[model samples]
Target: MSQFPHPSLPSSVKEPWLAVNLSLFFPGIGQLYAGKIIRGHSLIITQVGLYALSGWLILSQIGNIFIGELLLITAFALSIWGIFDAYDCAKTANSPSFEKLRTSQKDPWLAVFLSRLVPGAGHLYINRLWFSVLFFTFFVISLLVQLVPILLKSLIFYHVYIASTIRRERNQLPILGMALVSILFSLIISLQIFFIKTHIADTHIIVTNEMKPTLQRGDHVIVDKQIYRFKSPQRGDIVLFSPPEPLQDNHFREAFIQRIIGLPGERVEIQNGRVYINSQPLEENYPQKLSQYSFIPITVPANSYFVLGDNRNHSYDSEDWGFLPRPNILGKVTKRFFPPQRIGIVSS
Candidate 1:
């Protein structure tokens, strides 16, 4: 009792909610706010590294995949752990036992937010030299993991094909070794590219009103390119594709997404917002209605398709651009991934 003394803290100090909010903004800042400097800094470093690794995997898959999703879940768990730890630290901040190891260090929320935008930045905010160096190292490592493989693969191709220029007199075994290396390198690169182009696709929220009601403004969807490769786009299927002709004047070069109104060789007609296929009205369980528009019956040419937006009146689809050639088809929309309320399999 004589050796130990009561802890004194700022009268205005409110640790609990403040720490919780700080940790929410930046994974470790709340610990710093609650005088757990080392714990806070450690979390800052760990969280940033975890996120960078997760992001690298996500971009490598080129979008959502099982591995990337798992990585993200792990990252989220780390953040939650940090937040709870912060709350605990904050609760004990004013205790005499905590005072012995408590730090006078302060963490600016502004700095935390800045570091949130750029990893290891919060350390720089607090002017921690060693911590800043640690963050920079992690960032460099992240960049290396993301870019080095591609660069190495490119160099291999460049040196073997362009720089060296093939020699016929080379030894058989060495040629075999080079062949094996080239095959292995090519396989790695091809797999990444194939996954990017064929498996996963990411797109922003659609602003075009053509896909209203079913998919409105600020709705985003994931495209699965592998689907079309296995089977052709069928009627009522929502698909994304490079438009037959793009609006080069407006610099709008994005792939277009529209529901397939008619497949190749099908007779399609629209009468007062209702779509008729082969002289029968198409049945749709989805809550999308075509806008009022009368269109003459047209026979879809070979290897071509007729597309229309859910909002028929506002959409500039096959009606404006004629038939969509099979080669122009890009992928099929699998799910809506953005705007939380509308997130789910967008199509049945």
Candidate 2:
């Protein structure tokens, strides 16, 4: 065996051999090789913690904050620190006595961020087959669960004349009266030929009578589907929607018109023609008379609706058909244009 003196290494040689100062450019590397275990751990922990916190904040949809800016700054700084620390660690000569510890090169944050954009890419790169498959599955499921339905509903509402201008009111209107007005305007525009041809749907109203006395048969009414689609539909707001059974049917699952008597999750009862919601008697302002023919009380299903006709005794509606599913509801009926004489704003 060749006799050779092992190159000398200082016992406490600049504890941070990797240059902790360079860590400001990249988060963990400087501490990793610097031999300062606690400090390095802290740097890595802070970087990871900050990144996680920023991601959660973004998912929350909380706007009007400087979080994004701060995150970007920290990320850039950490990346730079990592690059410099890596260069310094590689340059430090390994002593012969101890086996040379060749530092491993990695761009973990960069790889993770890029892969996350495509869902499962990073895991695939890391050879985590199961996690990659799970990520891809969840990604597809999320698109179907959230994005697809929203797009479908938007298209349905558009065909039924729920225009975008009024559909966007829920986000803008704070006062109830303003919100109601917005719904009214949305309805009026849906019936006009100009509006109909343009495919605008807006407004909310309830039909008390059959198409004959109330709205002429074949006359199209537009309802603001976006109002309650975003917020909760109120007790008096006349919502135009389709019943669940018809929706379940293979054909004719497009749209149906009706009035909102009870909101989702509320108990509704019709006794002797008069209406009672949650055991409280509902007021009838439009119909000339009240006839309590059906005696039934039901709790409105979640994300579903309870509807009725203005002409209680004559009209066939939820009392006869079934609770209307919110998904089937294209928009709220806001306007009636067939019979000129009966043309006026539909009231709550």
State which candidate has the highest lDDT.
1
How high is the lDDT of residue 150 in model 1? Answer: 38
Q: What digit string (tens of lDDT, one per residue) describes model 1 on residues 71-188?
A: 7788899998987888788777566543342333232333333343455555565556565567556655656675554344323322322112222222334323443554466577
Candidate lDDT scores, in order, read 0.65, 0.50
TM-score of 1: 0.51
Best by TM-score: 1
Stretches of candidate 2 above 4 Å error?
1-213, 218-220, 246-254
lDDT of 2 by residue, 191-217 (tens): 463553333344333333442344445
TM-scores, all candidates, are 0.51, 0.38
Worst 10 residues of 1 by lDDT: 161-170
lDDT of 1: 0.65
Worst 10 residues of 2 by lDDT: 160-169
Q: Which stretches of candidate 1 lie over 4 Å from their true place?
A: 1-75, 78-194, 246-251
